[model samples]
Structure formats: structure tokens, C-alpha cells
Target: MENQNLNKILSGEKLSIDEEMVPGTIHLVDLEGTLNVKKESGSQSNIILQPQPSSNPNDPLRWPKRKKLAQFSLLWFWAFMQAVAVNWSGPIWTLWTETFDCTYMQLNISSAICFIFLGIGCVFLQPTAMKMGRRFVYLGCTIIAIVSNIIGSQGNSVQVLYVVNLLSGFAAAPVDSLVEISTTDVFYQHERASYLAWFILALYAGSDLGPVACGYIVETLSWRWCYYIQIIIFGVLLIVQLFYMEDTTFERIDRDDLEDKIIQQMKSRETILSAVQSGQLSQERVNSDEKLNAIVSVNNSINTDDDDESVDSSIPMRTYWQKMRLVETEYNDSRSWLTIFYRPFFLISFPAVIWGGVVYGSQMMWLSLLATTQSEIYSLPPYNFTTPQVGLTNFGALIGSLFGMAYGGPFVDWITIKLSKRNNGILEPEFRLWTMIVPTIFNAAGLLAYGLGAAYEAHWFVSAGIGQWLLGFAMSSSGAICLTYSVDSYPKLASEGLVLMLFIRNCIGCGFTFAIQPWLTRNGLKVTTWLMFMLSIIINGSFVVLIKWGKDFRRATKNNYYKYSDPMFGELFKK
Candidate 1:
């Protein structure tokens, strides 16, 4: 904004950019004398990227280390609880069928219904969080969890359980749609991949971890104890949330406000310096020159520590108490979602969004199908594993997830930093896509192993257990990579894009859950898995196409995003 030519570009006026500038490249730093973002790396540059926090110490990006951890932990636990509601039931099907006098198919249909409503619920819940306040949604979702769990524990009829589960699914939706957005609201660009990965970790752990407990409870105590455990967890989280889950939703673009203040101060300093040099003001009349000179001397000497302290003393900060408020300012009229809910659907035309959704949703659908298949397999035939052992099978997934959590999240961060440096910090979204190959290979392997082993009546551990760990690793890694790519590339539309992905993924999940039984029974596990391997290969291999043409896709969208879309939405992305 301080540079005249760049200001022209930001103001909707075209200045012919240099030939070196590409469609996918971002101009990260604006400091004078700093190295330009270019196509090759050499010497290191001492500059931070833009869209950074204001000096107003209240900015969440500027928050202290401990506060960041605490805030992230709170959202993570809530997300965990939401996911638990969906998968905890995986272990209780036997109890449910016996207690409610229903068939497995009925429970399958109910699960499918829950999946559908999970997306449906997000359609409303997401926009509410976007428009109203995150605090309100967090509180409401917690209350819903408490109430739904209570109802689930008491419900004895199939219809009643279905209703309770549907409500539970609804309550879980915000954790999906809001957590990423909320995390982005607080964390910086460099930290986003790690934090977002943790969110995915929480989600996967919540779903995968619950069956372990559910199996033991249903076998020893009662199936109702699953709901009781959820209630206790939610009760603790609810109390913590009342005090800790500060509203992270605000126009962080308020850096424009902060920048404007800085510019005004700069002009005053220039004026004072000019007066001092020109002798318009005597030495007795002004002390501003001495302060300005001290700042200049420190900068010239490269005493970075003194420079930071001096700048910190000059910059304004928001108080600790003020940062805790639920809403910082009146809602911007432009943020109104009267038409913004449809924005993500429009973004579906982008290749990055499509490929990411494919990699993510396909794996998610595969996982969902296995929950039923794994349970049904071990319950019968040569294995006849006890409920506790059935729960233990999830340990395979948990182990894989732990590995993915450890590997995928940090790997993306490391590779991105390396790639960014290699590219002279001129990042393209495709840099993140390289690591996705790991997931692609394993996605196919997992499906094939699980399906064939089961079809041939191979050992349960060989078929279901080992294969789940591989599939779980693939699913977790792919989900983290794709989502991090989408957000890094087009942060303004990330929430909408993610919601669209969720909606599609869940729809696919519902379809797969509905078909898995018939598919397995008719085609046998070997053939069904063979088809899955082929599909996984096709879906994951397509990442090559994105890597090749992703920049073009991003270019196309940038050209049309503001020009063809609603100005209200368009303006939100203005540089």
C-alpha cells in the first residue's frame, strides 16, 4: 500500500507487471530495500510477509505463546467431542440392534441419514458462525451435545435413537466448518498448516478413539455409558468454553486501519524532520527530531533488538481484557451472507478445490464404509472377536493416525518452507501438492488389502486391522495436505470452499454406506476392493494434472472472482 505502482494494482488499475511475475505468485514483503519475491533463491532476506498482525498487541496473531496453545486446545477438544458422536456408535450396533429390535440395515440407514444431516446442518450452522459470532455457535453446539447425549442415553426405540443421532450429527457440524476458519483467524500463515493439521488430528482421533471406549462400555456396562462419557466430556469442555473460547471472528483486515494510522504518523515525522533540517523550527521547539534520529541510528546500525523495542514502544496495543470480548465491532454489512452461502459452489470450478475434495472425500467415504464392514466381519465367521477386541482393532487406525499426525502436518510445513525458499519465497499452491503422492499410493493399497483379505477370509488382522492403519494414515495425510493447500492459496474463500468439500464428502459417504453391504454381499470383498483400488489410483493420480495447471486455474479464478461475482464478496478479497 505504501508503494505507488502496487497501490495502482490494488486500486483496480492495471500496471503491466514485470515479465517475471506469474499468476500464482504473491508479493509477500513490502519493506523498502527488501529482496523482491522472485523465482530463484540466493541470499537470505530479513522481511516478514504481509497480512501480518497489526502492532495493536490484541491481534490474535500477536498473542503470547501460552494463550495460543490454550485457545487451540479448547477448539480442538470441542472438535474431538463433535467427531466422537458420529463414530462412537460404530461399536454399539449389536446393542442397538438388540435393544431396538431393528436390523443392521436400519442402523446403516440411520448412520447414512446422520451423515447427510451433518452436511445439511453445516449449511446453516456455518453461515451463522460466519455472520453472527463463533462464540454463540460454540455455546449452542455444546448445549446441543449435552441435550442430545441425554436423549440418546434414554432412547430405547429405533426412531428415537435415529432422531437423537441426527441431532448429535448436527451438533458436530460447526467443529467441521468453523474450526479451520477460527484457527486461521488467530494463527499466522507459517503456523496455519501445523494448527490445521492438529484440528484434523483431533477430528480423526475423536472418531477413531471413541470405538475403543464404546466397545468396552457396551460389553461390560451398558451402551448408554457411551452417551454418559460424552456428557461428562462435554460438561467439562462447556465450562472451559464459557471462560476460554474467546471470539476469534473479526475483520483482521483492520490492518488497513492500523496502517493508515502508521502512515499519518510517518507524514508527521517527515514534516518535523523537514522543519528541523530547514531551520523552520528551533531546537527548543521540538523534541520529535531527537526521537526520530535515535530510531534511524538504531536501524542503520542493524541492532534489530533495539529496533523492535523502539518500534514496540511507538506502536499502539489493545489491552488484555479487551481481547476477550465476543465481538470486537459491529458486523460489517459486506460480511452479510445473504448470497455468500452460494459462493463456494461457484468456486467448485477451480481445480485445486476439486482435486483436494476428491482426495479428502474419497478417503473419508472409504473410512466410513469400513466402520460398518470391519464391525460386521469380526462379529462373524472364524474370527468371532469379542467387543473389546473389536474396539482394539481401531488401535490400528489410531496408530496410523498418530503417524499421519506426526508426519503429514510437519512434513507439509517443512516442505513448504523449503519450497518457498527454493522458489525465493514466491509460493505457488502447487508446492503443497507434491507430498500428496504418499496418500495416493496408500489410499489404493489400503482399500485393496482390506477388501481382498476379507474376500478370501484372510486373518482379521491382515485384512481389517493392518489395512485400516494404512488407510487411516492415507486419509489423515491427504486430508491435511489438500486442505492446507486450499487455505494457503485462497484464504478468503477457504471456509466456503471447505464447507463445499464437506458437503460433497458426506454425500459420497452416505452413498457408500448405503451401498457397501450390497456391494460386499453381491460382488464379494475382493472385487469391491479391486474397484476401490482402481478408483483411488484414478483420483489420486489426477494430482499430476493440478500440479501442471494449478497456476492457470488460480489465474482464471482471480480474473473472474471479483469481476463476475457480487461486488460485496469481491471486495472482501481486495489487496
Candidate 2:
């Protein structure tokens, strides 16, 4: 049976519930209620649990809802604080020019350095997190953030500022990549988009609203106080994490064959029950019972030792201190450090994943554009806005992002289910691509309004209010939708896929930041904005192509996916 299943997959067959596995493919919706896989146990019971939970009490998927939320809340707050540190310097760029006697270009270079380190950090830190466990990395990054902020508070030169951003960027790397993976660690597939939306919200809130508070701090206190406050907040966070943050890293054995057996047994049991109810019990019914027992026996024979231990009630659950331990070695991926470090690079061949990176990276381009120009544009002749006023402009993006979060998170999840039902109860990763249409339109329109309004010297609302709000919506929505799509497509590689996505995203951000001043000087606002608008459309509109051919891409890569998934297939180079 297993050999036949493998044959079907190699032959490019459409995926079915009982068929061989494809990395990005799964049976998500069951409208007829025929498949006997584990389902969500409520009104929405048709939703199948993707990467179904194991029988082990210690599995992160089986954790209590409140426990999951508590851990998520800590990571969420950590991301928010780290983002605030990365962005707080933006509002004070003008003040820093005088204090450090630096050029605006030099300050932009500092921002570019931060972006460089952010991408580099994802590549270097992910393997460590995969090995030492998520808790160890989170706590370690918090400590590094505290010390970096302390150094930043004492900065007296442009060079010192560069060093501070470098460290801060590395410390905050997990915010972009690891948070999503950690969120997936506990949440079911059906619940992920909504929570991942929350992660985006926390990220944007910090980048946008952090400037608001920083503007006020620079007005009343000094720029140094910005870092001082972060130092205090991070101190508190580290304490809370030490006591409460349990590691979510867990190793799960493949249970697909066992699940297939269970599904078959369920069908046979139903047949026997119906025969008995109709008073038609016969040799066939007895044979069905015998077949069920044989299926159970086959399943038991193949169960790994770890599976047997999971069902052993004699073993106690982990103790509180054990759960709170800073490092977890038991659940390590067992690959050499270099293997995990280089894995994301191999995913560059994955079409859907590369598209996801481009979609997400575009948001960072707009974000970098805003950061590079927000102070420069608003502080000029017509507006003559103060630092605090420049900071307040981000409020429009903040409000827009909140609306975007709702649409991208829960709304996307809801739409996916509806579309799956319409497709005869089979969910395709392409369903989420439909959400991109709204963002693509908004993104283009926002760039036009923002650039042209400034060129024509129209009302501030034309650019900052209407334009920024739209950009905020695009940034938030496109980010969540694309990320959810990539993970849904290749869940087995969620961690590695996200790392490459962020690496692409931050590299785009860095390159754009370095070029923003030169690009603006060379072309001026109107021409630059038009060019950007065209670029945004081209990159974001690729969703249409993906929607048309995404499944084919996943199909083409089945052999590659399986090869990389195997622990021993490439051990020669992995060592």
C-alpha cells in the first residue's frame, strides 16, 4: 500500500485524503464528513486539523488554550518592544543631525545598516533557535536588546549610532521570522491566520505608534530617554519570560499511515453497525469486524517506541521547572547546525515561496520609503511640522493597519473555508491569493496619492491622511495574507520558508533605504512615485499568476520537497 501511494505521488496525481503526501498539499475541508481524521470539535467541525496532533500529553498542539495564549502574549509583547527599539530613532533623525554633526544621507546609512543586520540576523540566528530552542533565543535576544539600548542612550557620534542599530537589528531579528513559527507551534491551521494577523499588528503598531511616543519623549525629555525607557521595559519582559515562557519546540513522529488505518477501521465499523441495525448481519459483517481488528494490529506493529511512551500513563507530565528551563535539547531537529542554516536557501527554487517573499518584501519597500521621507517631507515649508507632529502622522497608518489586520486575519480564514466548500470540500493554498487583489489596488493608489499630492503641494490629508492610511492597509493585509499562503503551502518547512521570506524582505528594505535619497534626488518626487507605483503593481499582481499555476508549482516540487524533508537523504553535505 505504501509503495502504491508513493507511486501515485511520483506520477503527479491530484491529492486525496488517503494518498501519498505532498509537502504543500493537504485535505483541509470535509463537507461530506466522510474522512475520519481528527476534526475541530464544534460548530465548525468540518475543519480538518492539518499536521494532526499526536497522542502525547506534552505535545504543544495539545496544550491548553490559555497556556498557549499566555506564551503567545509574551512573544507578542517582545516583538512589540523590539520593533519600538528599531524605529524610535526615525522621528529624531533631525535632532541627531545637529547632535552628531552628521548628514541626512549618513543617518539613512545608519538605517540601512539596521536593515542589513535584520536580514543577516535571521540567517544566523534561526539555526541556533532550531537547536537551543525558542525560549533560549527569545531570552538571549532580550538581554542583547537591553545592552544595545543602553549603549544607544549614550551615543555621541554618528559611528556610535551605526553600532547601536547594528546590534538592535540583530537582537530584533526573531520578530520578523521566528514569531510566526512559534505561533504555528501551538495554533491549529484553521486558527493561524487570525493569530498571525495579531503578530503583524504588534509589529506595525510598534513601528508606527512607537514613533508617536518617541516624538513626545524627544519633545519633553531627551532622545536618550527613548532608549532608557526600552531598557526598563525589556528588563520587565525578561523577568516575565524567565518565569512564564515555556518552550514550544517538540518533535512529532509521522502518523499518516496510522491515521489511514484508523480511517479504514472507522468505515468498516460503520458498515457493521448499519448491518446489525437492519437485522442483516451476515458473513460480510463478521469479515468487516475481523478486518478492523487486523487494521488495529497492523497499526500497533508499526508504532515507534516514542508512540508507545506517549500512551503510557505511568509517566508523569513535565514539572513546572522543567517546562520553564531555558534550553530544550530533547526536541532538537537532529540535523547538523549547518544543515538547518543552509536549508532556507534551497527553498529559493520554490515558486510559491519566492512569490510570497516578493509580496512581503514590497511592504518593506513602502515602509522604508515612508521612514526615509516622513521627516523630510513633513518638516518642509508648507507644513513646517515639528518633530512631534511628524510622529503624529503615523497615526493614520496605525488606524489603517488595525482595519487591515481584521480583513487579512479572520476574514481571510473565513473566506478560505467558504472557497474550499465551493471547490467540493478541498482547500487549495490558492484561495488565500484572492485576498491579494484588495491590497494590490490599495497599494498602487496610495503610492500615487502620496507622491503626486506632495508634488502638487495639495492638502496634507491628500498625502499623509488618505495616502498613508491606504499604504498602511496594504502593508498590513498583504503581509499577513502572503505569509499565511506560504505556510499553508509548505507547512513542513514553515520555519525555513519564513526565514528566507524575511531575508528577502529585509534585503529589499536595506537596498531601498540605501537608494531612497539618491533615487529621490535623481528623479524628484513625482517621477519617483510613479516608478514605484508601477513596480508595486508588477510585484503584487503576480498573485494572479500564482492563483492560476500555484498547484502545479507545488506538484513539480514534490520530489524536491520529499528529498529535503528526509533526515538522511543529504547527510553527506549536511555534516
Candidate 3:
């Protein structure tokens, strides 16, 4: 009987089950009036009554809070290590130029090559993660990074260094996108900004810390020791990850239970038919049974429908593979890769990204330039500071980063959640931008101070302190606002948006770092600082326009922005 019912359900026939059947038992019987026998069970019918599909307790989000923290920590640590490795090459750029007898342009090309590969890595790593899973991809990339660092350290030729730099950038690509994605996967929306902020803090902190640590090493030991430091950190991170980070893959829900329920209903109908053929029961009895069975079957169907709905709603519509191939026709037909890449350019084209590019890129440029230039400017007569002392200038940026991390992450998150609640569970990605106001003012002030301080050759400490606070605040707020807004505005295309931002930001940073030195030497720091200040004013001032009219903008270009399609978009825009 069970076999017949199972087969019937598998074949797409609906079955009705009794409400009083024994638990875990499949009952096959005829409905009181029906001419066919079908499977009916009270307990099996109840399976559909549950509201949600059971989540695996082993899932990363279900892991203990302490475990989640540990995972987050490990991610931050690896990010920091990668950041350090990137800038470690900065302090040693002069050394490489002198040793290899390469021109400044060639030396800059080495760093630029690393950054270019970083962007290329971003494009491929996300796709790789979808196939092999995030854990495997992260581990593989870190290991490759470790090996590249060691090889680069041992290389004696400029060509070898360039090749190693490119490879290292490729290997470290996962650290950028994967970490951000993983953080979002494991944490709730409210907690994401804070966690992301922490991640960025570690990233910038490494930039500051890397040069200082490597400068001392390069001065006392060989430039090769700088790469050695990265290898050691990578080794430590690799072990930490193996034990702590678990795969956060979304589970596939099974439909076998639904199939089985359908089978049981079929068997009940078959039983009724057989009884009629055998004349074991009168027509009256069969009719009564049929009515009872119909009621039970309807109830069972409802339960099954409920279960299916719950399961469907809990899982996101797009899976990892679908997201991986969003641009490819093999995955979706709505749009092409070229379309996806160019869409944002046409949509928001707000000077926000351009300004963000300037803010972030210029900071990196100035930091690198200042590190090398300080020695020539201040080390000779009055200060006579060594390479390590010059590296200490990074202390301001470091201090500012710490302060930004503490304030930006939790504060932005709290404000977003509070604003979301007042708005009735609807979140406008614009709420995240509110916190940027202060950071903008600070950033503008910092640029003005750093540029003027350098121009006047004022107290070194004054310039460092101003630069630190400004860049620090700007990094924290601008980064937080840009990411949050991108995610909220284009949740479906969040990854693509991130890729665009990353590419623009890195390219700008690389450009400025290469050009700032020459520009400052030719134009003077005062002139350059004013240029940055004016840029910030224009960029920061746009926020007023956006905050006041952003919703109108979103509504005007409904096709361009996904936030418009969201049910909450209309209501939220009213506020």
C-alpha cells in the first residue's frame, strides 16, 4: 500500500490523509464516498503545517556568537595582512629603484601592475567562489599569496619582482570581495555596516602599519625581510582559518516529503476503487468515506502548500551560481555583461563615486608620497630623522583610522536601524549617508591642513595630525556611505556595484600615488591642497542635493535603480 501511494505521489497525483493517523505511519484507505483508494495519514499531513524549513544548526549564522566573532576576527586579520603586504612595497620603492637602476616610472609601474591585477582578480575570484565555495577559494588564494611573497623575497631581478608583484595581487584578490561578501552572508543587514567598517579599518590600519613595520625591517635588515614578514603572517592566518571558518553555503531544500504526501492521497483513491470492484462495502459507506477523505485531502494540501511557501520565502531567489553568472546568458537572459557593466555608469553617474575616488585615492597617494618625501624634506637639517622616523608620519593616519573604525561602524549601523524602524521596516540606502556629513567636513579640513602644513614647512607634527584626522574620517564615512548606498540601491547588482567602486577607487589611488609627487613638486603643496579642498566641497555638497532629491532621482530612473521597484520605495521616499 505504501509503495503504491509513494509511486502515485511521485507520478503527480494528489493524496488525502486522515487527521488521526498514527505518527510516522502511512495509512492507505478509501474516502467514504470515493470509488478509488488513496493514502491518508494524520501525522504525515501535519508536515506541511510548519512555517519554515528547518535550517541546519551547523550553518554559520547559527554558530555560537563567540564562533562568529572568531570567524570575523580571522577575516579581519587576513585583510590586515594583505593590506600590509600591498604597502610594504611602498616604503621600499626607492630601494628597488636604486638597486635595479630602474626609472621612477618603472618603479611606479610595479605598484600599478599589482593594483591592476587586484582589479582583475576581483573579476575572477567571485566566479571561482561560486564554483568551489568561499572557503576553498579564500584558502587557495591565501596560500598562493604566501608562496608569492616568499618567491618575491628571493628574487634578484627586477623582472622577477614585477612578476611576483602581479602574482601576489592576483592571489590577494579574494581578500577584498570575498571578505565583504562573506561578512554580509553571515551577519544581518543592521550589523553589516559596523562589521564592514571594521574590515576597512583593518585594511587602512595595515596600510599605515605596514610601512612603519617594513621601514624598520628594511633599514635594519634586507628589503627581503619585508616579504618574509608577510609570509609569516600568512602562515598564521592559514592555520587560524582552517579551524574557525566554516562554509556558509545555502542549503538546497528537499521536496521528497511533498512527493510522499501526494502519493498517499493516490493510494486512498485506489483502495476505494478496489473495494467497489470487490463489493466488500456498499455505495453509501463509500460515499461517506469519500466526503471525509475529501476534507482530509484539502487539509493536507493546505498544509503542503504552507510548507512549500515557507521554504521558498526563506531562501533568496538567486543562488550563488546564478549570481556568479548574472552577466552571462547561460545563467540569465535579462541583460548582457556589457549592459550590466555600463548600467551603473549611466544610472547614478553622481559625482559621489568620482569624489570618493578622489578622496580615497588621494589619501593613498599622499601617504605614500609623504613617507618618501619626508626624509628629504625634514631629515636633513633640523630633524635629521631616519627612515623609520619618516615612517612614523603614518601614525596620524593610523590614529585617525582607529577613531573612524570605532565611530563609523557601530554608529552607522545604529542610525540605519533606528531610521529603518521609524520608517516602518523600510530602509532607504540614503539613511546611511547621513553620517557622512561630519566626515566630509573633517576630510576637507584635513586636506587643507596637510597641504598648507607641507607648503609652509610648519611643525611636522601639525601636518601629520591634521592629515591623520581628515583622511581617517573620510575613509570611514565615505567608505561606509558608498557601500551601504550601493547595496541598498542595487541589492540585485550589489556585487557589480562593488566591483565598479573597487576598480575606480584603486585606479584613482594608483594614479594619484604616481602623479602626486611630481604634481606637488611642480605646483607646490598649497596649490594641490586647494585643489583637493575644492573637490571635496563639490563632492560633499552634492549630498545635500541627493538627500533632498535622491528619491525623485530614484523614481525618475525606475529602470535604473532597483530600489524603485521595491514595495517600500514609494513609502520611504515620502519621508
How many steric overlaps are in each model, in order? 0, 0, 35
lDDT of 1 by residue, 268-309 (tens): 444544655767655455544454343223122221211233
**TM-score of candidate 3 against the unseen true structure:** 0.69
Tell me the tens digit of each residue's lDDT in model 3 across 525-563. 688779878877776556666577655554454454434
The Cα local distance difference test for each model comes to: 0.69, 0.82, 0.60
* Lowest lDDT 10-residue stretch of candidate 2: 296-305
Error of 2 at 238 (Å): 0.8
* Per-prediction TM-score to the true structure, in the order listed: 0.82, 0.89, 0.69
In model 2, how large is the Cα lDDT of residue 75?
A: 89
Global Cα RMSD, each model: 7.3, 5.4, 14.5
* Model 3 poorest ten-residue lDDT run: 22-31
Clashing pairs in 2: none
Q: Assess candidate 1 and give its lDDT.
A: 0.69
**Top-down TM-score ranking:** 2, 1, 3
Report model 2's TM-score to 2 decimal places.
0.89
